[model samples]
Target: MRALVLDRPGTCDTLRPAELPTPLPGPGRVRVRVEACGLNPSDYQRAAYGIPEWEWPAILGLDVVGLVDTLGEGVTAVGLGQRVAFHGDIRERGGFADYALADATVLAPVPDGLEPARAAALPSAGLTAHQAVVRRLRVGKDDTVLVTGGAGGVGGFAVQLAARAGARVIATEAAHNTDHVKRLGADAVIDFRGEDIAARVRELTDGRGVDAVVDTIGSDSATANLGLLVHGGGLAAVAGRPDLNAVAPFGLAPSVHEIALGAAYLLGDHRSRVQLSIMLAELLEMAADGRLDPMLSRTVPFEDVPGALVELSGRQVRGKIVYVAS
Candidate 1:
């Protein structure tokens, strides 16, 4: 199979063409024909963070929607020709290929009425959002949640989920995305570039602060986000660790999370499968009903993966960049 393998992890061009034998399913694995794949921040982070070194010839993908072309022995759940999506195995090449094998344990039947590109965009970002709000924090009715980077991939989903869970949402975004983010169900939005996010949350909550703070962007915003949460409230940072003491002065002990997508999907149990199913159902239902929109910025052919990723590293994107396998 032709895959955009990380021949050498130096630059995007290093992710050149490579001929690798098509992968076959092991006892419980299923071989999938790649259709569409979504790029995540981790994709670039992996390359820059010195993870997928060239000597390894790694494939850079973790989430995809594809057709099950073959199934390994004893894999009784999914069948051949079934269109499904999941967080592809991290131990192997990512979704940047024509054919890749997936573990049936993490695979979910694509919800009816969902498009492959759309579905592909959900697994990584959507799963992160679901983990932070639905599983970790468990945002419930009447909760007030503040999601930083509200228009971002994970933040967009977080805003929607938190709102859908009956939480009053105050999201932080750039000036231009304020309205765009709010339509996703945020009750209020602050321009991180223009407004004081911490103060905005306080104002929205009438000095009480939000119940949970989900920061999809960190390295700069994590510490401040902690201060926006109420005492004893939770703070989930998808990017990095936050200063717990930022909320300590307020009596709030923030719970920080550094999302490990691999662990979330491969937690040797039914936990990953159950969560994957539920999030897919909710996101697909919202999309099918026009209540959810991905704000997809663009689509690139499989061959353009390298070039596309270069631009993605700029951190100027408005939404998901989908790579459609053709």
Candidate 2:
């Protein structure tokens, strides 16, 4: 099998194509003949910063859509040649290759007629947004929600989902992305670079603040947005941890949710891991029915994986990028 192998913990330039023995599935696993793989910031983050537990020579595509080629023992849930999609475990070899491995329990069937690249784009970003907006924030009718980094992969989906749920969505983006975020159903778009997000959001909501905030760009953004929540409102942090101390003086009964999408797999929690599949299934259904946009903005050939990762690392790409297998 041909794979873009990471020789060591380094930049995307270190990724090189090489021929390696195809891996066989262990019990409860299946081999995926990769059709498409989505590019994500985490791909470059892992390549550059490296995970403490991950071994060297890693493959870094996490969101995968492919056909199940071979199933291992006890893997009766999925069949050979079945098309499926899943967010791959980051600790293992990923979908930036001709083939990849996936746990049968985490495989979600890709609906027929849904493009592989579109399905591939949904596993990670879409799932994170779904978990943040739908599960954690519980955004609903008449609620006003704010999404930081609204043009980003996770943030874009969050804006759309919140809007679909009848929430008045406010999104923060650069000036250039104002129209893009608005097209994604954001009722109000704030220029994060030029304006004060909290003030703008407060003004948009008539100084009441939003009912919930989905913070995709974390660190200071998370902490600042925490103060933008109404009393009893929720803040779902996808990137970094918010400083609880920052909001202590306010007496705002704020709900803070730490969203780590991979924690379910990392903790060896079978139930939560299975929930990944369930989430992907629902997301796929939404995409198939035209209710959700996968927002796949670019599709490149398989060999462009490394360059695409480099591009993704630059943080200028507006939407999801997927590399299709030839």
Candidate 3:
């Protein structure tokens, strides 16, 4: 099998194509013949900053949409040739190759109408959004929620999921993405480049601030989102951690949460894995029924993985980019 392997943690140039043996399923695991894999922030993050746990010549990718080629012993829930999507572990084998190994317990069966690329896009970003908005923040119908970077992958899904739950969502995005955010169900869009996000939220909420905030950009944006919440509201961040002092000035006493979907799926407890599988299944069903779009931005063949990594690292992408397995 051909795969893009990182000889050592470095730039995109370090990711080189090479012939490698296909991974086989172990006990409680399954070998998937990968059809499509989604590019995520973590992929480039590992490339830029080395992951100590990932050995050299590693295949780095997370989301996998493929067919179950072989099953390990003790796995009877899914059968051979069954279409499934799963969260690949970079610490083990990943989806950048022709075949990847995954724990059968975390696999979700893909519905008939969902394409491989779209299904591949859902596991990481969609699951993160679901966990952040639905579980961590506990957004309700009458609540006003603000999503930072609402036009991007996780943010887009957050907007949709929050909207689906009947929350009035406000999103921070580029002026060009106004319609994009609105289509994802944002009740209002703030042009982050030109507008004051916290001020806008205050104005939109009649100086009361939002009931919850899903912060995807992190850094200063996460700190800013902490201040934009109503007193005693909730917050979730995908990238940055909130400063205790920053939240102190709000008088809101917001409950801060860090959303780490990758860790939960790859290294979490049994209950976490069950919740991830259930969310992936629900997301797959929604995509199959045309209720959710994975927001597929582009599809590239496997050979172009290096260039794609560079492009993704530049960080201008609006939605998910998928790689079709060769």
- The candidate scoring highest on lDDT is 2
lDDT of each: 0.79, 0.90, 0.87
How far out, in Å, is residue 96 in model 1?
1.2
Using Cα atoms with residue i matched to residue i, what is each candidate's TM-score against the true structure? Answer: 0.91, 0.98, 0.96
Enumerate residue pairs that collide in model 2. Answer: none
Tell me the tens digit of each residue's lDDT in model 1 across 1-326: 98887755466656888788888789988899999999877788777644532336788887788899998999988888998888755667788889877778778777677888887888888888888998789999979988888888899989988988888888888888888888889988898888777777777778988788888877468887776666678878788787665554635656666665666544645676656656665666677677767667788997788888887788777779889988
Ranked by TM-score, the better of candidates 1 and 3 is 3
Each model's backbone clash number: 2, 0, 0
- Candidates arranged by lDDT, highest first: 2, 3, 1
Residue-level lDDT of model 2, residues 1-326, one tens digit each, is 99999888889978998888899999999999999999999899988877767656788899999999999999898888999999988888899899999988899999999999999999889999999999888899979998988899999999999999999999999999999999999998999889988788878888999899899887788998888888899999899988989887659989989889888788858889899999999999999999999998989996788888888888889989998999
Candidate 1 global TM-score: 0.91
Q: lDDT of candidate 3?
A: 0.87
State each model's C-alpha RMSD to the native. 2.4, 1.1, 1.5
Best by TM-score: 2
